[model samples]
Target: MFNQRSSPDKLMRIGNILITPLLVIMAVVGCTPQPRSVDVTTNPTPTKLVPDMRATTTVIPPTETLTPLPPITLDARVAEIEALMTTYEQMDLFSGAVLVAEGGEIIYEKAIGYANREWSILNTLDTRFRVASLSKQFTKILVLQLVEEGKLSLNGTIDLYLPDYTGPGADQITIDHLLKHRSGIVGEPAVQNLERIERDYYTQEKMLELISGFELLFEPGTQWTYSNFGYYLLGVNIERVSGRTYADLMQERICVPAGLTDTFPEVTSDIIERRASGYWFDAERGFIHDSPLDMSFVFGYGHLISTVRDLYLFDIALREGKLLNSSNTNAIYEAEFRPIGDETCEAYVVEDGPASINGFRASSHSYIREDRFVVIVENVRSGGYYLPGVFEVGRNIAAILYGCPYDQPPPHVGD
Candidate 1:
């Protein structure tokens, strides 16, 4: 049965899955003062426990009159990004692809580093990488589509759809709770012991069985917790109600209609062209192969793979109401602003960006009101040779586009 109230300790456990060790590094390093020039190719490496030199130094005045810089045009913005990316490449902090768009047209697009590092195969705009939790947005859209069609109800309980399932608070957990990650279900259990179980493929039934046996972390709707289990179950509910598999339904409803050729459920065994090989970094071992997992285990939660261009199409489609009506689309954005786990939702949320997994990280910004968007997808992990923080990479690009003050990535010591 669902608990009516949540304990403080339980509420504190709602950690965001998207936050990676790299973000921790950034938090500790903190932000530096923005430089006068945009050239980031020569920024000094960060050092630990540096004394406050700013307090001790005397101010100096220039003899000549300072000239104010000219306003940057759209073409200049593209060139600035290219220069920034070149600096990142030299620093060994970035690899993969980036695409920026405005008013439904691509303004700038570029690819850096190798897709298959072993073969030295260069990454291109077509190089597909796992979008990780960005897949959740797609899943959310599918569920909303069903709601619009009257095939599913947002307030409907899990038991109403999957009566045979016996998860805790099955009757009390509503579709809204699952979509918002307030269902109290735990998801990290499936990720643990990956080394032992990843070799074998898991069917939806097998994954569900594993998730259902676990007790609720908190009562449904009492507290927000990001749960892969919640989304997976929602996927199952979609399957049960629509009488179709998650993949088939996504194809028929979302992908086909949007003309998303590159976006689809990842099938590990099948030969996928232009798929970037995943890589992770270790202090002791340097860049290492990302541990493999059966794609089936990540169904509806994270399995979709795509390129930047395909994702851009998705953004445009959503903005133009190709998938859902204007009312439903607005509702989706409203739901997005409702707090997720411990994090407070942004007041004027304009984008859904940043999805990180083991070896790959993806982020896209659709400034719908501003009529501009940015997409950055990296195939390298942080703490590697020169890889920058994933969130920082996205932030820098956005700053450049908006002509806001921005700091270059602090140099990693080893690099």
Candidate 2:
């Protein structure tokens, strides 16, 4: 079924919507021989230099106030969401797009805030946003496709795919372990714990070496530890087994067949169309430019860029069993899922959900017992205040849109 319309403010409630959340992701990817971390630290530049953009919103004097968005409707719930987003926008907590659909019909769609703050360019419905950790779900589907094709096995050890791998967990971590996060392979403490690694540059070779040397946090399969490096290794193995690149796999295996055009692996050098500039907020300074990242560190797990529409296609693909058999497609929920909000709210549990990176945040989930879909991609990060993540935002939207249970969000006080 085709979806409906989008607006910057005051969107129409065209019809009932699906209550599931669709994911968002960002960045490019790199693949190694097998089970190796890879990414070409995003070109020669240390940070992305956003080229000047021309759009509906023209240049505004840096010191001048921005023109106010005209409100579209008197719909109360829609107004609540619009108000919530506006508050977030003023607070520099969110800047991107949202889409909600029910029964395969578009119920609500809107873009909020700036895509390129320097240019005063408004984020449109089609603006591309990095899905970040949301890429893992996409990766999981690809892996299952291979498993379905008998090209890979869920229980296959890393060494089975990457004979070159000799790390301590190489033989111990199975594809299943990686998928379920039972690999015990946490990221390097120095890298993972860094508060600002987004500003640091890392080479593909260096990232690989670091992961190869990491000691497992515990025995594989006996523990469930989310590992980006484990997903990175899966990317390597995805390439090694299929004898294809990640982009190729995405284009052929998923995008082409599923009718997803604006979705693909992020490449550092390519100038993507309708791409949004990443941003971070500072309480004293307001919106700050999102720093450039040049690390191959996020290869498979985090380096994907997409739009709400294309991601909706992806969600539909999985739900309709277009990507895999019914048995395997259900694997999306087979992993460990932590509940969405605290005791005061009722929302779906999420598994390996995305955490914000530099300029992007996202939330995608399904099955709220209402056949609804709630997808939001926020292209800015919060630096000054504790911002409710897109996941929390999605939960609130779901409550309003599909009559799901939720309460007003508690303040996230930041240091």
Candidate 3:
């Protein structure tokens, strides 16, 4: 201030001195250490917050899978069903064999009541029963087999085999008509025409002769009419083409293939031990011990002797296509509706429905419903009050287990 202004060189030297010291102090302050975090809190306790420093690794346990259980065996359920049959045996209501099976495995089997009440011999599983119209299925199979082999066709006429046998409506009928029960030949001349016939000695040829004498009930293929004559003609056709007795053909072709050792086309002295005595109900005859009524008269119509076990085996084997080709097997499974055609026939909607188990003139009906409901009822002894009630009891048991409709059985008459 006293000197006022200085020289340019002197002023520059004084500014450099001041600027060098200030730069040194600024560099020292930037390089010096500082606090990691600064506290900015209004509370009394001021603190720095940080995440947990200790490291951790998460591990999840593996999940365990649950295993499924096995199916119930047929053998396990057999005893429970056998108990139901036992009740009927105790009341003396039913006799003969009953077997229920699935997939070739016997689930329940029993032989109740007497095979021969006169001899006091009880029935066994091997005891045979006359399986009436069921024989038609066998005859049907034999014909179909011939069709498969090209030996015959379903459309072939009867005249192709049976020459010199001329009738008014014979040419109008075809082999297919016979298999389908549509031939409409008049059968049963009277109320029980088949019952009075001596069934012991009639042969296939004789059956044809008998049927040929009858009139045509309706035009062939016009409609179905249950015709034993039609099946008789089929038996004739088989014998004529194969040149083998009907019995031999059935034994070799069907019985052997099905492994039904106890089943046979006829009963003779050799099979006396296996045959069940036939019974009859008449005002004058009373209870009689008749030998197994010969199946000869009905041959291809109503003549088959089989045990329940053998029948079940045959049924499953045929249905499963183990015995025949799949197409042929399916053809047989298609319903054989009655020619008269009633709504009642369609009312029963279950697999393997009512099966006709026959004696001589009398036939028993048994059925195993879907959902595993089984009912086997029969008139082993006719005119006995207990047989009908036994069937009712069987239905009740089936309803309790499977919830199906109960069948009301007729009164059982005593011998």
- The number of the candidate with the highest TM-score is 1
**TM-score (all chains, Cα) for each model:** 0.78, 0.74, 0.66
Misplaced by over 4 Å in model 2 are 1-80, 86-92, 192-206, 334-352, 402-415
Cα deviation of 200, candidate 3, in Å: 5.9
- Better candidate number, 2 or 3, judged by TM-score: 2
Candidate 2 local lDDT, residue 358: 60
Task: List model 1 lDDT by residue over 138-238, tens digit each.
Answer: 99899999998998998999889977568789999999999999999897654678666755798777877778888898988999877887888877888
Q: In model 2, how large is the Cα lDDT of residue 171?
A: 79
In angstroms, the error of model 2 at 307 is 0.4
Residue-level lDDT tens digits of model 2 in 1-415: 0112222122211122223332223222221111211111111111211111111111211232323223433255566666566555554445678776554555566787777878777888878988888888878888999999999988888888876565688878899998887998876354664546544555545556667776789999997766888888888788889998888998888887668888887777688898888888665666677677643557888888888878777776666677778777654644221233221223332233445556888877553233456688887786645556777677667656534334443333341
Best by lDDT: 1
Q: Taking the tens digit of each residue's C-alpha lDDT, what string does model 3 give over 257-336?
A: 77777666664324545676766433345455443445566667666676665665556456545556777775665431
List the lowest-lDDT window of 10 residues for candidate 2: 36-45
Number of colliding residue pairs in each model:
2, 25, 6
| lDDT of model 3 at position 367 | 26
